[model samples]
Target: MKSTLNKTDEVNGTIVIELEKADYQENVDKSLNQFRQRANIPGFRQGKVPKSLIQKLYGKAVKADEINKIVTDEVGNFIRDNKLKILGEPLPDNSDEKLVDLENDEILKFYFDVALTPEFDLPLDKSVELTCHKVLLEENLLDEQMDAYKKNYGTYLSVEDEAKDTDLIKGTLTELSDSEDKDNLQVIENAILMPSYIKDEEIKSSFTGSKAGDKVVFNPKKAYDNNEAEIASLLQTTKDKVKNIDSDFSLEIKEVTRYQEAEMNQELFDRVLGEGVVTTEEEFRTRIKSELEKQFKPNADHLFIHEARDIIVEKMKEVKFPDEFLKRWLLETGENRTSEQVEDDYPKILEDLKFHIAKQKIAEENNISVEFADIEALAAEVAKAQFAQYGMTNLPADVLQNYTKSMLEKEETVQNLYDKATEDKIIDWLKENVTVIEKEISSKEFNDLMNERTRLQEEN
Candidate 1:
């Protein structure tokens, strides 16, 4: 057997593999012997069939199987021996014919088109500056977040006074119309509504000072913005009948519900801060600030990656790609996709591929590696978050262990965790090697910068 690579350029090549009969005859002979031992025929007992008989019955099949095994092994070995920085996988050379006479042919030739990755050096130095945005937690923003927390944890109280915009009114709705026919008349009873929906300002104003026995009149459909079905249900009538009925209706307020603000005391603090984590209000506020900072770390990290990518793009030039070879390779390998569709996405794919290769090179230069333990740790954090999402905040030790084990056991879950760890490691390497310029900017400015960066990346 002879294997050779013909290089057309730095980023394009062809791998040619020529196999002789001797390359697979030994394996073919072994397979035939095994088949002979297992062969069952009319005249021969099991394990006693003649080799010639077995060959006559299954020679073609055995030969084909042996050739397949040889191809698989030789292809992998050839790629490894040549140290090919391949993109995706090798595509079969389109010019090669598929038909081959295994019985008569002494040599079988297989051709494949290979896309080689262009070699590039890492340009990591003080020359490349990446801006890192530091998010500062303002007091007003913290207060707003606190207000939201209070609202979420607020208690509902049954009030005996008039319904207000913030108050929920419980009452029965009755639909009335000019039609005297009892079947034609529509009525909806026992419906709850908020007085804020009333279109008539005077009627809505009346609801603010009115008590439970007071009644307010307004058009149900008009008040609810043409919500006929909702009006029908509220007025105890069919949706079709609601259109025929008078749009106006009277709401008799039976009860008023008000929300009571939660007290920001020890109990609230304990609930949010894991029981005695912060003893005093000052300490609690400080902890909240710290937590906000930590939460913003991921956003900052994302921006850092964007900036690093831009710096790399700016510093590095002359990225050579075998576009014609890659496009052909993509068209050939993508089974269900058309060449036109592949071509449409080729630019974005090439950019992403270049960035990935560049980052990989950077990681290699910095000796960055993600260990198995790091992946396991990340998997556990993901599992914990998933459990927390299902309202299981305080999971038992055994249950947490079991959950993490089961999560890591999943093929896709483990792969996702591994990829995340690898990205993190690469990002860390970039942060260390590249010069980062810290910038203080408003959240809005930060968002704009990110959007502009994304636009630039997409445009390329």
Candidate 2:
């Protein structure tokens, strides 16, 4: 067997592998012998087929199979031996068709097109500065959050007074105009309406003083601020028909409901935080601050990563890629869409791929590793947060373990955890070793910057 690579350009190369009869004759013979042992033929007992008969029947197939195996092995070996970081799997060169005749040749020659990875370096030591915002929780923000919490745990009570803007009113909605042509003027019973949605200033004001059993006639469309769906729902009509029908409807109030806010005490804090976690208001506030900080850390880290990527890209602008070779390689890969489509997305793809390779190299240099335990712990944390979102704060140990195990068992979830763990390790290494200048910015400003960055990314 003989193998050689011809470099056509910086990124493009052709690897030719030549296999003589000696390279595959042994495997061919072995395959024929194995076939003979398993052959079933007329006039022959089982496992007693003659070698000559087996060769006549299966020689061509055995030879072809052996050649294919040899070719695949040699291709892989050539790549490894050359230490080539390829973009994708090698494709059979168009020129390979003329190189060898499978019917008569004792030697097989295979040609493949290769795309080499572009060489690049990290720009970590470059003078690049990025602001990392430490979000300071304001008193107003806490109070607003506390109010939301109180409302979430609030008590709903039935009242005899008229519905106010903050009140929920239960009424029987009836349509006055009933014509065979106006099927949309059908009435609905036991519909609940929030007074906040009522549009007419006079009608909204009138609702505050009227008691139960009072019949109020108002335009459904106007009352619901011209919300066609809401009007249709109140008048029992489809949205399309609601526009054609007259908007007048009668609302017979049956009940009025009001909500009383929950008292913030030790019990509330215990339920929000872990049981026995906070015994005082100060402790509760501190816990809230801690939670806010914990949440802010990832956002801050993301901003830093973004700034670092910009810095790296700016410094490494001189690094060049063999775009033509890459485009050809993508066309041959047969994974994504057409080459034109891939080329359209190539800029971002190339940037991400380059950064990923750089990070991997940095990780290797620093001997940074993400442990299986770290991944498992991250998975568990994710599972805990998902449970917490559903108000399941105190999950049993067995239940939590089962949920985490199930999450880790999913192929996508496992890959996500692996990626997160690897990225975290890489980022930690970068933060510790790289010259990062930390500048403070307000939370609102940081959020605006993040939103702007996201908008630009989406546009790209």
Candidate 3:
């Protein structure tokens, strides 16, 4: 068997494989002999069937299979040995091959079309400019974070004053009727309501100054904007029965509960920052500010990376690609993708492909790589962030390690983390090479920048 790569252009080529009868005849004969040994014809005993009969029955099929296997293996070996940088798998060129007389043909020929990777130069230097926006921890932002923590650890307290919008009101609901007959009135005990959640302003205002044992008459359906769910819950009935409740209901206020934020004391500090991390209010605030700075660094780095990518893309805008070949590849390989869909999505796909190629080239030139240890570290960080969302920041080392290990056991998770690590390494390399101008801005300004970026992307 012999294979040769014929270059059609810098980005396209054809691989021609030539197979002589000697290349496949031996394997075909060996397969036929094996088939004869396993033959189960009724007229012949096992291992006693004639070779001539077996050859006549399966000769062409066996020969074709052997030739295909040889051609495939030779094509792959040729590509690998030559260090060919191809885009997608080689596709068979059926148009170049004619019907062969397998019974008498001594040499078989096959053709395959391939797309080669395009080459370009992207040199990273101080010429590339980027801005890294450092988000300053504004007092408002810190106060907001502190307030959230206090609310999470807050307690509910009973009050004897009038019901406020933020207060939870408990009462007994008694349906009122104009007629003297009050035996069939609907009575609901321990009904709960919050003025803040009331849909009607008039009804909500009526409960503002109502203290304990004060009775306020209001229509449940109107107060909740005729919502069946809310009315049913307040009246202790199903949605189907809420429609029958048309009379006004009197709510006798039993108790008003107000939520009070946890005090800035030793216990609060211990619960929030882990035991003994902070002893006083000043220390707690300082530690929280420090934590905010640490958290904000990643956001600044993310923006820096985003800006760097844009600069790279704009610089490499003139790089060429095999447009027709890639479109064909996408249509053929993508599952259930129509030509119209591929055409519509090709621009974005091409942009992403260009960035991917650029990243590969940069990694190769810089000797940057993602190791197993890097992925493990990233996985551990991810687990810590997830746990921290639920206020479990100070976890045991073994617990975090076990969670990270479980995540790495999943193939999809490992692949995702590996990709993230690779991108992160490349970003680090970019930061080292490019000119990054660091500017400190307030949190609101940083948020505005991010929001504007998102808005522009959505518009495009």
The TM-score-based order of candidates, best leading, equals: 3, 1, 2
Please write out the lDDT profile of model 2 over residues 1-460, one tens digit for every residue: 9999888877778889998888889999999999988888999997899899998999988988899898998999999998887776787766645466767887777888787766766656435455556776667766766776677767878888656788877788877774566665556788777766778887787677666888888777667777889876666658997786665678888888888777788777876776898889888778776565455566788877777677666666677666776667666665867967887878887777667667677777778887879889998888876765554556678998998899888899888898888777877767776666676655567778779989998998
Candidate 2 residue spans exceeding 4 A from truth: 2-14, 32-58, 77-83, 96-98, 151-262, 387-396, 437-447
Decide which is better by lDDT, 1 or 2. Answer: 2
Which candidate tops lDDT? 3
Which of the numbered candidates is closest to the native, going by highest TM-score?
Answer: 3
Which lDDT tens digits does candidate 1 get at residues 266-329? 8767766567777887887787766665555556888787667666665555788888877887
Number of backbone-clashing residue pairs for each candidate, in the order shown = 4, 0, 0
The lDDT per prediction is 0.75, 0.76, 0.85
Residue pairs clashing in model 1 are 172-190, 173-188, 188-235, 188-236
lDDT of 2: 0.76
Q: What does the lDDT read for residue 133 in candidate 3?
A: 78
Which stretch of 10 consecutive residues in model 3 shows the poorest summed lDDT? 94-103
- Candidate 1: lDDT of 309? 69
Provide the lDDT at 324 for model 1.
Answer: 86
Alpha carbon lDDT at 28, candidate 2: 95
Q: Which sections of candidate 3 miss by over 4 Å?
A: 33-42, 45-48, 97-104, 154-262, 265-267, 290-302, 455-460
